[model samples]
Target chain A: MALQAGKGLLLKADPIAAAFREEVKLGLSKTSRRPRLVGILATSSAPSKFYAEFTRKQCEDLGVEFILKKTGAADTGDLGEGEGVEEAIIEANEDANIDGIMVYYPIFGVQQDHYLQQVVSPYKDVEGLHFKFHYNLYHNIRFIEPQSLLTSTVPSAASAGVVESEEPPPGTVKSIIPCTPLAIVKCLEHVGVYNKILPYGDRAYGRTITVINRSEVVGRPLAALLANDGARVFSVDIDSIQEYTKRPQGGADTSQRRYHPRHVVHPSNASLQECLAISDVVVSAVPTASYKVKTAWLKDGCVCVNVAADKNFESDVRDKASMYIPAVGKVTILMLLRNLLRLQQYKAVN
Target chain B: MALQAGKGLLLKADPIAAAFREEVKLGLSKTSRRPRLVGILATSSAPSKFYAEFTRKQCEDLGVEFILKKTGAADTGDLGEGEGVEEAIIEANEDANIDGIMVYYPIFGVQQDHYLQQVVSPYKDVEGLHFKFHYNLYHNIRFIEPQSLLTSTVPSAASAGVVESEEPPPGTVKSIIPCTPLAIVKCLEHVGVYNKILPYGDRAYGRTITVINRSEVVGRPLAALLANDGARVFSVDIDSIQEYTKRPQGGADTSQRRYHPRHVVHPSNASLQECLAISDVVVSAVPTASYKVKTAWLKDGCVCVNVAADKNFESDVRDKASMYIPAVGKVTILMLLRNLLRLQQYKAVN
Candidate 1:
C-alpha cells in the first residue's frame, strides 16, 4: 500500500504540491505590502471542504490569509420556484470583506436557469461566471477571475484572429487561451516534444489538429488557440462529424495515413469504429454514464483524454491508455491553486 | 492534378486563406479610421509571398490595404558575424505609413540579442516579440504574442499570486497563458465536455485539470491559465517519471498484460516503449529528424500530435493515431492575424 501510495504520489501528488507551493509563493510575493484577502463562496460541502483544507495549507506556507464563506447549496426553490441560490449569491456579492469570491454549484440542477445570471460583485466574482466577468473576458478587459480558463478564452480567440491574418489588432489584449487545453500543451513541452527534426527554439508550424467536439467553452476556444499557435485545426462537432468524413480526401500525405479533409463524425450517427479509427489523438468531452470509448475502438499508440468526471470507463481499457487524467484528482487541485495565484497577480497589476 | 491541387487546397491553402480573410475583416472592423495598414518585414521571400497574396485577397474583399516591404535576405556574412537585424528593422519601425509591422526572420542566422527590443515599434510590433510586449503580457497590460507558447506561463504566474493571496501589487499586470494549449480547453468548453455539465449562462466552476509539461514557454503559462479558470490542476514534469513494464505471467490470464509502475523511465532516458506505454495523450515536441514514435510503441487509441516541423517520420502509422497536428502549417498565419486583431481591440478599448 505504501508503495502504491508512493507511486501514486510520484504519478500525481508531488507535482500538484510543488505547483501549489510555487504558485502560493509567487502570489504572496506579488502583494508583499498589502494584506490580501481571498474569499471562497461555496455552497457544496465537498468543494468548500477541499478549498478550506487546500487554502489553509497554502496560506500557512505562503503567510497569506484565506477565508471561506459557506452559503450552503444553491436553494432550489427561493425566487419563482428555483431562484434561491441566485439570491444567496447576490447577498454574498454585497459582502465588504471579500476580495475574490467563487460560488461553487453543480453544472446542472433545478436552479441552473435562474442561477445562470445571478449577480456577484465583479471584483468578488472570482469564478468568472458573472456577465461582467465574461464581458471583460470576451472584450479582453483586465479583471480578476477565479480561473484563467474562463477569462483567457477571449484573448485566445482574439489572438487566433491575429495569427490567421496579416493585420492583428493594435493594443489589443493578446488572447488568453483556455487553461485545461493549455495544460496538455504544457505536458508536451515538459516532455520536450517538438516538431520532428527541428532544433530547439525552432517554431512548430503547420501542424494539423482535428478536434472532436465544438463546444464554445472548449472546442471553439481550442480551435482558435491551435489556429493561433500555427496549427491547422479541423473542428468537428460531435453532432455533425459525418458530413466532414463523407467528402473526398485531399492534401499531401505527410504521415502513413492520407489526409482526409472531412474526417469528423457525428456521434449520434457514427459507428464506434469510425469515431476512433482515424484520429492521432482522441479527446472526448461527452458526458456519459459509462465509457463512451473502448479499447477496441482505439487505434494503437494513440493518445486519449477523457475530460469528463465519473469513473465512466472500463478499468481494463483505462489501464491500456497512454495517459489518463481523472476528474478532480490530485493533479487538478494543484492546477486550480496555480490559476488562483495568477488571477490575483493580474488583479494586482491591472 | 486538379484533384491533387484541390486536395492541397483542402489540406493547406483554403483554410489559411479563409483564416486570413476572417482575421483581417475582424481585426480591421474593430479599429482604425481607414483600412488598417499591415506591413510585412521579411528577409526571406516565403512569408512575403504567402502574406502578399493572402492578405491582398482579404484586403480586396474588405477594402483594406496590405503593404509589403522586403529588406532582402540579410547578408549571411553579417548575420553569421553576429550583427543583428536591428538596423534593417529600424527602417520599418520608422515608416510612417506602416500601421502594423511583422518582422519575419529565420530563428537562427540573425543575432536576436536585444534586436527584438531595438527595431520594431511597439505599436507596429504586431507579433508581440518585444521585451515591452512580453512585459505587457506578464502584467496583462497588453496582449500581443497570441500563439506563442510563452503567453500562458507568465500571466498565470502573476495571477496565481493575486488569486490565492488576494494581495497582488497595486499596479502589476498578470501573465498571459499560451495560445495553442489553451485552445484545447476552449474546445472542450464548446462541446460541453464537463462532468457536471454547467449551463451556458451559469458560472463555470468546480472543474479540475492535470497538466503534463513544464516548458517555461508553454507549460508554466498553461498551468497558470488553468488555475485562473477555477480548475484544480496537477502538473507533472519529465524528471519525475518512473518506468516499469509487465508481461503475461503463468498463463493465468492470456488476455491480460502485466503491469508495473517500477519500470517507469525518467523523461530524459525515455525509450519509445516507456514514453508511449503509459501516456493517455502524447503531445510530442521532440525535435527529431524522423518520426520518433512507431505504431508498435504506442498504446491502442493514443492521441498523438507531432508539433515538430521536420518531415522526419514515416507516413504509414495512421491506423494507430486518433489525430495528428503537423508543424509550421497554414494555421499559424491565422493565429498571427487573430492576435493582431486582438491587440488592436485591446488598444481600442483601453
Candidate 2:
C-alpha cells in the first residue's frame, strides 16, 4: 500500500469552496449593510465550546458581527435553562443586523438544540438547521421568501414560512441541507467528485458509501445526503460493528429511491469484511478507538472521512485509501460561514 | 416459483396497527370533546378529490368531525392559486375545533402542495409533514405540549414552538413517523415481520429492502424510517436499475457503526436477481408502469408494498410473492385518521 504521509489523500474544501466564498464575500462587500451572526451555546461540552469559538473567529475574519450567548446551570435554573435560552434567541431574532444564528450542538449541555433553534427567525437561520429551513426545503431555493441571493440550497428568506406561497415543481429544491451535510458535499466537490459524477459532491454516483453511527446530527443526515445523490449508503452501529459484518453477505437493497439506503449490518466480521471489500466511501461519525482500522477490510481506493474529534482510524488506515478528510469540523465552519455570506449577499440583492 | 393468488399476498395493516388504532379510537370516544379534522384540497385531480372523500368517510366511521375545504380553479385563480390557498389554511389553523389539518397533494395542481401546508398551525398538522413535526420528533410523544394528545411521532403540543424547552435525553424520543412510512411499517408488522424480527414491527432487523423511487414524500422518508429501525436499505432508480445493478460493487464501507449501508450492485441479472433473491422486503413508492414487474427477478417470500397508485407490478408478479400491499393509499388515510384519534386522546389525557 502506498502510504504517503499526508500528501494528496486528506480532503479539504479548497479551490472550489474557497473560490465560492470569495465570490460571495466580494458581492457582500459591495453591499452597504454588513452581515452579523450569533452563536448560542448552552453547554460546557468542550467540543461545543470549541466550535462556538471557531465560529466566532471565522465571523471576525469575514467581517460579520458575531454574538455569543452562553447559558450555564445557574442561569438555566432548576426548571431548565430552556426559557432563558429562548429569551436570548428571541432577542437575536429581533435584531435587525443579525443575518444568521446557529446553536452549538447539545444546546445547554443537553439536547435542547431544536427547542432553542425554532426561536431564531428563519430569516437568520443560515445554518438551515431550523424547522422553517426544512419546511422551505420542499420548495426550490428560488421560491424562498424575503429572497436575497439564495444559495440554491438554503431556501432564502422571502420563502420562509410562506405556506400559501406557490411552490416550484417537485425535484427542484436542493434541500436547505444541514451544515455538516453540506460540508461533506463541499468536500466531495473539492475532490472533483461533485459536478463530475454525483450531485452532492460525495463522488457517489453509482458508488457505495458506508456511514458509521445513526446520528440525527451527522450519521443519518449524512446518509440521507448521499442517498439523495443516487449512491448506496450503508448505516451501522459503533458498538456492534464486528457483529454486523459477519452476519450475512447480502443486506437490504432499496429501489434506487432516495430514502432507502440505511442498513444496520449483522455485526459479524464476515459481514464487516464483506462491506469493507465492496465499499467506495466510508464515514466514521463515531470515534472507533478500539477498532483496528488498519486491519479493516476496505477497497484500496476508498475515500474516508472522520467527523468525530477522537481519531477512529489507525495510522496506516489512511495509507490504504485514495483520500481522507481529517478536517470535516473545520470544513463545516468554513462552509457555514460561506453560506452566511452568500445569504447576506442574497438579502442585499433582494 | 409458486405464486399465490389474491388469497394470501397483498400486504395491508395487520392486527397490530388495527389494534393500536382501535385502542386510540376508544380513548377518543371516551373523551367528552369530539375530535374535529379538516381536509383542504386546491385541485380537481381525481386522485386528490378521491383521497379527500376517503378521509371524510373514514372520519365519519371514527366518530370525528371532518371538514373539506376544496379550492379549485375559480377559487385559486391564476398566480398559482397560492394566495387563496394560504387564507383557507390560516383560517383552518385558527379554528379552535379543528383537531387536525390535512391537504391533499397538488394543492393548485402540478405539485404546488407545500404552499398550502405551511399555513396550518403545527398543532393541527396531523400529516406530520411539517418541519415543526420533524424538529419536535426529538421529544417523546408523551411530552408533546399544549395538552394535545400528540401523535407518537409528532411530539405533543403545549411545548409547541417553545424555544427554551427542556431537552430530553438523546435517542429516547420515538419518532412520530410520517403516515405513509408508518403505513408501510404497519404492513410489515401485519405480515409478521416488524416485531417478529424488527422492533418497528417491520421485522427489518438485518433485512435488506430495495426502495424504487427518489420521492421526498415517500421514498426518502421511508428509507429514513427503516434506517431508524436498523434495517439494511438499498436505494436505486427506476430508469437505471439495470445499470446500477451492473456497477462495480466495491462501495465505501463505514466502520462498524450505524447508518451507512447503501451499495451499488454489480447489476448482473444474476446480481439483481441475487438482491431480489435475498431481499426480505421491497417497496415501490412510484409506479413503475413502464418497467415490467412480471419478468422482474425476485424471491418468493419477499413481502412488498407498492405505495404508488399505478399498478407497477403485473398481475402475475403478485402471484409469485409471499405478500404485497395494494392498498397503500387506503392504508395511509387509515393511519392518518388513526393518528388524529390518538392525538385527540392524548390531548384529552393532558
* Interface RMSD for each of the candidates: 22.7, 18.4
- Candidate 2: tens digits of C-alpha lDDT, residues A51-163: 78788876787777788877553234432323245545666766667888787666432123544555455556677665445434322132433442222122223443222
In model 2, which runs have C-alpha deviations exceeding 4 angstroms? A1-62, A65-350, B1-8, B11-21, B74-83, B108-112, B135-175, B197-203, B238-274, B291-295, B345-350
Could you give candidate 2's per-residue lDDT for residues B59-142 as a string of tens digits?
787787898876543244432223245546766765668888887775432122432344455556678765445444322131
Best by lDDT: 2
- Winner by TM-score: 2
Q: Taking the tens digit of each residue's C-alpha lDDT, what string does model 1 give over A1-350?
A: 12232121112334434664576566657764433344433343464456557655755566655655443242232212222333344444444444554444442231222123223433444443433333232222332233342221222222211122323234332223334444544443332322545432222233434555554344544443443343444555533442222122346455663222212221234454664665444555554556466767665544454555544334544444454433323333344344445444444544
lDDT for each residue of candidate 1 in B1-350, tens digit (9 for 90 to 100): 12232121112233324545566676667666543555444344464456556655654566555665443343333122212334345555555555555554442221222223223544555554443333332232222333322222222222211232323333332222233444433333422332334422111234433344444333433333443333333334544422211222235574553222111111134444565665444444434465455656655544444434454233633455443333423444444455555544433433
| Model 2: CAPRI class | incorrect
